[model samples]
Target: MCRGLDSLPITCLERAKELRALFGSFLQKSDHNLKKSEKLKLSDVKELLQWKESFDHLLSSQNGLCLFRAFLVSEFSEENIAFYLACEDYRATKASKLAPKAEKIYKEFIDSDAPREVNLDYATKAVTKENMEQPSQSCFDEAQAKIYILMEKDCYPRFLKSSMYLELTRKTRTG
Candidate 1:
């Protein structure tokens, strides 16, 4: 079973609480005096409502992604999103830098002893390790896809039902 916020170390739990408060304050801001760019675009109810349409919609919005990342942290599953973002960044790396970048990603998120190692099937881990030998842009594609699916199918739904999400939507509606 996945560990929840209750299982997090006190420091982690405190950080999660801080993030939640930060996010809540962002949502509660009513000041219109700020410049257009200074205000979070997600303050718009329409934009926040769009998050319910699809996972891609939520991820596409910078604010939405930030909130979702915070939610993942609270769940102690932030590594999934971290790995996904790292792979996305890795794919854009210059060819000359691919090997070193790939090595860094593997060591950080794929190796058995990695500090933030992501859950993966034995076969997937072996395939990813093999792909590391060549260090192509596609080296992490399979593993990234697996993590993406896991998040979309598992985490995303729970996120939609989370109190933080519900409260934000409700506040947007009633505020």
Candidate 2:
């Protein structure tokens, strides 16, 4: 039997397969990859520094979100970011999924025994649990806003002072 010209030896085929896998994983156009390819503009850094209202804009950007998450991680407050994101995603969930999703979120982040509990006040936590009796899109609103404000007032300042954020500013200015 004659093999097609496009066919290769088993060793060559194995090498090609390995290379394909490597490129597939390494070069995929993910948020991290996009940030790596396109550095933050100097104006972006300026807005982040000068505009207090622009924290929402910063969180909306992939690189900014990643940088803020890194800051949270360093401060051991990553759970706050995780809970805030979970709430954001929960807001868009389908009506039919509201109950179970709310339950899961409450158990994960609001419950006293949660593995990643957020620092909510007793009243807010109790109200959230009561809301779980009839889960809805607004069930987590209060808790979420508290977390958002906490980050805006507390974490945001610390993040700006972080060396990672400082390095980013330096790169945007010089490079």
| TM-score per model over all chains | 0.77, 0.71
lDDT of each: 0.81, 0.71
lDDT tens digits, residue span 58-135, model 1: 888766776787789778898888889899999999999999999999998899998788989999999999999999
The runs of at least 3 residues in candidate 1 whose Cα sits more than 4 Å from the true structure, single-residue gaps closed, are 1-43
Candidate 1: global Cα-lDDT? Answer: 0.81
- How well does candidate 1 score on lDDT at residue 50? 89
Instruction: Give lDDT tens digits, candidate 2, residues 15-118.
Output: 43443343334334343455643334334545444423567876877556655665576677878888898999999999999999998999888998887788
| TM-score of candidate 1 against the unseen true structure | 0.77
lDDT of 2 at 90: 94
The best candidate by lDDT is 1
